[model samples]
Target: MIVSNPKQKITAVIPIRRGSQRVKDKNLRPFGDTCLMELKIRTLMQVPEIDEIIVNTNSEDAIRIVNECYAVGGVKTYRREEYYASSECSGSEFFRNLGEVTDTDVFMYCPCTSPFVKPETISQCIRAYAERGENDCVSTVSQIKEFLWLDGKPLNYDPSNAPNSQDLPDMVALNFGVTVIGRQDLINNRNIIGKNPRFVVTSDIEAIDIDTPLDFYIAEQIYRKTVIEKLELLE
Candidate 1:
């Protein structure tokens, strides 16, 4: 049971570009009954704490779908510039441009790539951010207790002396499924992860990020096996 605070002006941003290199218009591709972009918008709408949901995209198909389905529920579609839509555009560039669009107390960067990111998880993250008096930002992350390596070097453990998986230091992988940051932080830092950022640890299923075709397939399977099956049982 999450309580909504009316005074907190929270805006959710979902960026979908027209072109996709790996998945080929993955945002508009059919997932279950609705497309990915629509699914994300629908999920965001369920969270009462979010005052506004903004979909920044240059895709006409995305705009049409939003107009047809989600135009009523505090969902606004912004016509993204061609420059920002390019694959060459950096994440910082997007955030910097996004600041000019809406003025809210908090900005939530919600990617449509993670289809399994539930409304409840989002609500909880928003609640955590609002309650965090001193913290500047809150981003969703997945806890990894397994061995980690980078450049053939053990990142989380020593090569010669390895500890048990449970005893090892729990590493957090940033999912980027949901990132909440203040307007000032976005303007100043030009990044989602602020100086004093709090982490919202999420389940592995909830952290499914779809980049390639294989990733999309795996995420879809996980969503069906975990989320949809759970929902069916509840009914």
Candidate 2:
């Protein structure tokens, strides 16, 4: 049962698969006390600008858990096919399917691995896309100053220059936490990034994603230390 919000027109699509090569049961694994997907749902639910959220997965346990504990009126689940559950399955395919079902003007692609993604960032991406008017896709990015290389060779070609990180022109990389895409571009191009892609720069703190056991541990610690304190104050 997906809740319909007439105020906002954006739809959020979260594609979660059962197969995880690095960490077993990654989506269902507990972060603090709640499962990863549950926390992701909680985060999405808090955003006023998100009209609806759909979970695309095939795992029986995941469906059961989400249905029992996380099935809100605005959140719906889609059963993915075995073919789409493969390790080679492209996320773009899921996004395409979701686009067909919702027909939303703005499609937000959020990953369940990033539990700490704030609603503010989600709203920010939405506003950025709408205001830009010409953007086909918008994604969060972090500026990096570290030495980069390709094929065992330096990329910047200046080994001697150790300029202050702040002084150097920022190089941005997709953070993959939150992506806002226009429906028309995705349909026309079959990709997130169309001809005009917007990059929203974000802080490193909002970019922590859980991929391995170590990553989970670090996220858990960070949540307990910082988010917990903030929540306690709200209480």
Q: Which candidate number has the best lDDT?
A: 1
Residue 56 lDDT in model 1? 89
Candidate 2 ranges beyond 4 A from true positions: 1-8, 91-102, 229-235
Report the C-alpha lDDT of model 1 over 82-120, residue by residue, as the tens digit: 988887889888778877676787888998998888899
- Alpha-carbon lDDT of model 2: 0.76
Model 2 Cα lDDT, one tens digit per residue, 1-235: 1123234368788878886678788888766767778888888898888877888888888888778876755678888777777766676775565566555777888888877788888888877877766666789887887777799877754668766656665788877889888676676666666677898887777887778889988888887788777888999
Give all candidate RMSDs, comma-separated. 2.5, 3.6
How far residue 91's Cα lies from its native spot in candidate 1, in Å, is: 2.1
> Candidate 2: which pairs clash?
3-73, 3-74
lDDT by candidate, in order shown:
0.84, 0.76
Candidate 1 ranges beyond 4 A from true positions: 1-6, 226-235
TM-score of candidate 2 relative to the true fold: 0.86
10 residues in a row with least lDDT, candidate 2: 1-10
| Candidate 1 TM-score versus the reference | 0.90
